[model samples]
Target chain A: MPRWEPDAVGRLQAAAIDLFAEQGFERTTVAEIAERAGLTKRTFFNHFADKREALFGPVSERQRELVVAEIAACAGSVSPVDAVLRGLQAAADVMFEERRAAVARRREIIDANPELREREWGKRAALADAIVEALRARGVDSGTALLAAGVGVLVQQMAMRTWAEAADGRPLREHLSDALLSLHAVIGQRSV
Target chain B: MPRWEPDAVGRLQAAAIDLFAEQGFERTTVAEIAERAGLTKRTFFNHFADKREALFGPVSERQRELVVAEIAACAGSVSPVDAVLRGLQAAADVMFEERRAAVARRREIIDANPELREREWGKRAALADAIVEALRARGVDSGTALLAAGVGVLVQQMAMRTWAEAADGRPLREHLSDALLSLHAVIGQRSV
Candidate 1:
């Protein structure tokens, strides 16, 4: 049995990110992260399965839930792609708009490591799959659902990137709208 | 130094895919794959770095080169997304169209493994990066280039999936065109 620790996950995540950014992710250890967080290795194990999972934390899962819930709330009359965009925009508002600096740091750390990069790709794919399921629940065909999910993923990616990197103070939802318009223009400019 | 073997890469890939599909990818070994190809482990190393790489083989790199070459040859007058579609269509003709069965087998083997799916995502991203570079060289703005590349990747993914699964004898390029049109319609249906 383990004793309770207040805000242990938050402390551990902050400590882990700082250490990973300071000494590089490969060289950092779970023990070091636990020490920095003023917690025990057992507590670390309680929250995350490993060092890699620590890097990602739980925010992604929360965001996925928010997006799926938003999609489910969309009325059947809403277009499939529109529903996905609405879900992304809603999640961005709740999860990402306030975490600009932290999100940027996480992106940098993941970008620097190939294995982390792959894991990030897997996470994005999982989110897309969740979106697809939500869209299918609204009676959209499989093909349209898939393409809409694809576009939604692209919008999230583009919006998150710009929201994190750009010095401008635009909110993430605005970036989502911008990316959707940009994608619309790109697809509409088709040659074939 | 290794002796020259006729179509060594082809034989190794076919053998590896068959064994992986027959006896699961993790259960299969490089030695088993090499034996199935009637080649030594040394020959396998000379061709691919590992069992996973053997699964992907050299076809992806060849396709990338063909796509970049096609993009470079496109006149500046062509629109950015159009140029990307043309490049993808050109590569499909030379690399994928006639090898539908082979491509389907490879996709199945990759899809069965989570790690391989991440790698497949990475490969698609790499192709998108190559497209971005090609478009940048043509003086397209970076944002537009990235979005165009993103759309191109989506088009490739959808086309490859349908071409592999659909029993109808439509060519890969036709699927590419169809996917592009579908994407256009999806994006054009945006609510926001």
Candidate 2:
């Protein structure tokens, strides 16, 4: 029997983050997370398969959806890299800007744990896959699509690394643009 | 005491690849690999830690060393992306160019196996990290260095994917150059 609880997933996620922060991720248990969220173990399982999913669950899929949709919606006039940046920036605005704190903490925890870092890479590969499909839908060639997706992923990672520790509270989208510019300079291309 | 054997590692790798091709990777045994090489299983253990390592062992570390050494030898006037390409080309000439058939077979086997794919990605990450270190030593800024390393990796992956499939017998260095040009075109920059 499922409890008809609104935002059960949200509650569970918040509870898991708090518990993961208080006790190390290795020490945190599903039972403790459930209790912290005022839910049962059944509800926890209903929402997430395991304790690690508690941290990686909600945002990863949704952000991918947002980016893919945005890429699909991009006009054909946009270059592949620009299209990817637009998609990434759109997702940043909708999914990341408000959740910077949680995103940073999640990254920190993942960085500290080798297992979580591996999972993060898997998640990244999936995102790139979706972007490739999205670009293909827009008539982009396979090689260009793959290259653009790889560049987009690199920019996103660099932006996230800076965005997390930035004291000036810059938006992730700007950081993404800046990273792209840095990449251009590194490649000896004129600034965009 | 180990038996004195010349080219034991090379013999083992060739034997392992042949056996892995004849039988599936899952069904192939280290003992069989050693036997195929006309060496004892003891010799196999003396050379490589496991079956997987037999495939990945010798080339990866040596390739990284070649890349790092070449990057260090680049003149100060060389840009990061060019410096990386030179390093990669040097390594490709020394480690990969002459071994196209073996490299292609190894890639085919790795691509078909999930465990090998995971190890492949880990190796790619390590190469990127080594590029980062090499660029840092050249006085490149961290952000640009990271981006350049990432770009180099993407170019390398794209080149490898094509190099394995190309019937034209193109050198991996030319493929790398083409991939980098594709990236610039994708990003709407003038091809270098």
Candidate 3:
């Protein structure tokens, strides 16, 4: 066995989701989640700031960092939308490609609790801001950058919903690109 | 003085904002706001459920109902984007056209507090869901309806920020229409 498990944080998140669903998010305790995961409370704290953080903390931060970095690194030939798509594709590969079951369960937990849902909104808003900043750095104006980033995040929202519910095990990037196409179709032929 | 005040709710909102800005939301009490408004606690409770409710209670609910009803009323004779814009224009006419300064202050208070910010987001999310339902009722598919609603809400968000900060004192309806136009320009065009 490896000296350190590759997915300690993932295990903690899984355990937390199981506990939250079996009971309610409000009633489930961190101690119970730790016990279920066969990890010490110290280990849990090392991985997540608190019980709520287990569901939202690391994944959001890592995704933000990855997307912003990827956008910053895109070649000059790419359009802003394509750059955002590229960034989202990179983050999706690391955070979501093989984690469908866990992602679905986590979504259920968030949907069931108003607080969690609000936090999820906050996370997405923060990510949108990060993407906008990256675009601005790449010389996009404030207005266009804001709109493109908002559209990209909206596509992310749609793609994630489809990914969690779709029967076909298609990659999230496919849905994301499809959503961008749909956005194009809807916005149809207006001059920017 | 009129027997029935025209702006009892306005007075209450102002008092609540002052108290919250001065003492913070959690520390401020409903009774204090009522007293500051020269009304009894019963009057405050009659207008709102609690202290926090004073800031968000009526405007949010009224906006949602107005937009959804407007969309339903425009069920025919327009595309989905046009329908959503019509709904948003109706809301701007009712909720925000004359309340620019008051709206700015309310936004500031919410910005100062995490709880208020979350509730504001919750209200925005609720409004988006209501729009989606209205679109679906008009025979739009669930996916397109959701995207239309999301884009409409995004337009609302952008228009609101601009209106709140715009010194030109232009009408919110104009900004909203302008935003809808810009959204059409951005998403309507397919570069590929």
Candidate 4:
């Protein structure tokens, strides 16, 4: 029973992020976010279950579906790590490529709040679990599936960190690829 | 102003784990844990900051110090992953080899509670940060250092899972070594 608004979700997210940045996440309220976005609390509720969810909810499910589908579609001969990176790259293309500033802002907000950081960790853990299950569906052994998924999550984290900090407008996929190479180089280097 | 009892910390931890496992973590109180250990709540607080820390506090710092020291002592010719695995193996020998049952029980307790799981994740992240710092001190680049430390954590997790589930009573160091080999096999396997 809500009037349709163009880009309600987008407005709500932007408003929420800006308010959180301005007043701090703990002090921000859903009603204030709705007011800032020129929407009702009911409409905000329709879009997100809570303030934290406003920042993270939509992308997790969408990214999970996209990454899992991409993994399923990969050639049978792709290495587990490579398959995971491919899925991650595909997800980056869809979710992160054009959202650099927003992503950086979100990171800063999450970093400033311990509760938000815990939720972010939970989200990352769930993403790794999804990737592990996807790899298992491809007949990967459980142990290797978990390792590859863990590696994939680590790569995504490293790439995201690098992408967020880089002033150059480099694509997230390139950063992801660079992260994978860095991992390989780290794993490959001799102690001497 | 406290009389030191032999193994007071150990007794408190064992009591906390048993109570957490028996009646669930949320319902278990610090006072009850102390009583079960035949110690005062003051004694318990002396050993741990809270009920949750009873399970994780002492070992994390010790393990961090041990692993960092081992990483620092590795031969100059060892690969980063190898050096990390070596450090992990050294720590496992001291802290994990003989504590399989207790460790498994602690994992089960943490796994059952969302808050505990978050704390566990935080502890792990801190450990990874320590490892990254150690690697950087060794002249490894920051990106590669983070990646290697992440892989080290993954290897430790895999080894811990395998060791906790194994009935053979094998040394944890062996499982740590086996996990490293498994990771190599996983990353080395051709997708085709």
DockQ of 4: 0.46
**CA-lDDT, candidates in order:** 0.87, 0.85, 0.82, 0.86
Query: What tens digits encode model 4's per-residue C-alpha lDDT throughout B85-167?
Result: 88888898898887888899988998788778767766777788889898888887788788888888888888999999999
Find the number of clashing residue pairs for candidate 1.
0
lDDT of 2 by residue, A56-75 (tens): 88778998999999988877
Q: What DockQ does predicted model 3 obtain?
A: 0.28
Is candidate 2 or 4 superior in TM-score? Answer: 4
- Most accurate candidate by lDDT: 1
lDDT by residue for model 4 (A1-192), tens? 667799999999999999999999999999999999999999999989889988888888888888899999998889888899899999999988999999999999988987687677677777888999999999988898998888888889899999999988889999998887777666656443
Model 3's TM-score against the true structure:
0.86
Residue A148 deviation, candidate 3, in Å? 1.8
Worst 10 residues of 1 chain A by lDDT: A183-192
Pairwise DockQ winner, candidates 1 and 4: 1
Tell me each candidate's TM-score: 0.94, 0.83, 0.86, 0.86
* The candidate that achieves the highest DockQ relative to the unseen native structure: 1
Question: RMSD of model 3, in Å?
Answer: 4.1
Q: What are the RMSDs of all candidates, in order?
A: 2.0, 4.0, 4.1, 3.2
Worst 10 residues of 2 chain A by lDDT: A183-192
Q: Give stretches of model 2 more than 4 Å off.
A: A1-54, A189-192, B1-16, B19-54, B189-192
Per-residue C-alpha lDDT of model 2 across residues B3-57, encoded as one tens digit per residue: 7789999999999999888787899999999999999999999889789888888
**CA-RMSD of model 2:** 4.0
In model 3 chain B, where is the ten-residue run with the lowest total lDDT?
B183-192
